[model samples]
Target: MKITQIEIYAIHLPLIEPFIISYDRYDTMPSIIVKMTTDTGVIGYGESVPDDHVTGESWESTYAVLKHQLAPAVIGQNPMEFEKIHEVMNKVIRDVPAAKAAIDIACFDIAGKTLQVPVYQLIGGRFHKKFPITHVLSIGSPEKMANEAAEHVEMGYRSFKMKVGTEVMKDVERIKAVRERVGADIAIRVDVNQGWVNASTTLRGLRAMRDLDIDWLEQPVKADDIDAMVEIKSKADVSLMIDEGLHGVKEMREIIAKRAADKVNIKLMKCGGIYPAMKLAVMAEMAGIECQVGSMVESSVGSAAGFHVAFSKKNMTSVELTGPLKFSKDIGDLHYEVPFIELNEKPGLGVTVDEAILEELCKFKDVVKEG
Candidate 1:
């Protein structure tokens, strides 16, 4: 079936609390949601939560691209031709992965619904029906961070991702306190969001937390600095996972060639959507690099897409799709059992969207159909 109409919504979802990282703070997440209606009466959904600091995209730009370029490009095209759809999007514009991701996700959703299988089956089948989720702790004081970890532990969460990349010694203390509070059994990872800015500071930070048993350190330096990543990996005892530094396959190849990182964080927003994300996971598996499916603090519509990717791939050893947990309300249904997110057997992303809720949350809306 061919896609006939695409609806775009610009929404602002309030976070339960202010989410602060090394570079920015957010009390609300702005996202662009896409609704694709096909000729045979099948409908599909997608969401794009762009981060200017991460994907070099913002809500306005993402919405603009979806309405003016990507949505129109996909009209009248077959939803099953995922590769061709991506090629057309790339030709229309470049580097707005978040914008392209929305259309891509919607396309996958329609394909899955039409094929009568889940999105995971289309990719690689389900290796994990339910995976452990790493609840992200925003940047805070040592005591505060430790307390938050303890609280999540009491809630049955066993894995935690702590935000760092502030002061080196203080960041060390923050991890130390959380480790002490959570004990040795709980899994703890760190994400700097490229806060260190250089090899020396990252090395110093890694050295200070050498004995803390951090599962891995993520993106300590800037995104483009492959040389610094190589230097930090060579000098430090910590395992590095590149997040901000990785986007497409080219960057993945560079990271693999340089031995810059032990792991890679694949977010749909970073690499476009499920289609390219699966490719990245395969490339990482070939390179023997473990993968983590990360989120851009999306609602259930987006997080469900990520969960499918994380569950389908064997190499996606870690998951951080806890964005739904951070939001007070969502437009889709997702089941969260503290540390794990479970998926249903419904076709496509397997998410049921509440259109009324979506309308309520939308700040702007537009429809793109054939003229």
Candidate 2:
């Protein structure tokens, strides 16, 4: 089928608590959603994590990128021709891969619907009913963070992800407190978000974290310093999963070849859509790198796409698609009102948006376009 139309929306879903990181504070998540319609009556959906902080996308930028850069290339092309679309997107906007990725996700959704299969099947993963979800614990005093972890666990969550990147000793002290509170056996991982001091300190800190059973340390150093990353990887005993170091298939292969990291956290926005996501997974598999699917702060529409991608990867080492749980409110019917994002057995992503809710909770009415 051929594409007939494209629709974009700037969505803002408020978080229960302000999600903070070294980069920015996210009180309300903003994202660009793309919906494409084909001649044969199939509709595919996609979401983009804008470049800026707080949903990382603004309406103006999203529209300009979509209408002028991304949409133009894919308007009339066949959805099956993902390579051509990928090339077109990359050719037009070399660095803004997130915008290109949004359209790519919609194309993949359309492809799966047309082929009468779930998106995961196309990527070679069996459709499991539910995947274990890990809650995100913000950086705070060890006591406060531990309490939060305990609360989620009391609510039935068994896994926890903690944010670090502050001071090294302080980070270690907090992890120690959390480990003491949780009393071991629960999988705990630390996401430093590139907080380590330098290559030397990173090696020293990682050696300590390894002894603590950190499970994984994500992007412990600056993303660009692969040499530093490799040095840290060489010294650390725990698994080092690279988040910022991985972009797409090209960088994925490079990281594996260089041994810069042992695993990767594949964000939907980072990979740009399921097409590259699947491509990256295949590339990772060939190179022996385990993949983990993750998300930006998104409502169910965007979050479910990530879930499917994560569920479909056979070599999925760990997951971080817990955006829905961390946020205070969700904006659509695409999700069940539960603490965790549960997977369904329906066809084609298995969820739908509540337009009325979108109208009330979303920032942009329908399309993310220029004035």
Best by lDDT: 1
- Tens-place lDDT per residue, model 2, 114-221, is 888877766775645566777888778789998888877778777788888888878888888888778778878888877884678767676566657777888888
Model 1 poorest ten-residue lDDT run = 334-343
Error of 1 at 225 (Å): 0.6
TM agreement with the true structure for every prediction: 0.98, 0.90
Error of 2 at 85 (Å): 2.3
What is the alpha-carbon lDDT of model 1 when measured against the actual structure? 0.91
lDDT of 1 by residue, 23-79 (tens): 989999899999999999999999899999889998998999899999998899998
User: Could you tell me how far off, in angstroms, the CA of residue 157 lies in candidate 2 after the best superposition?
Assistant: 1.9
The CA lDDT of each predicted structure is 0.91, 0.73
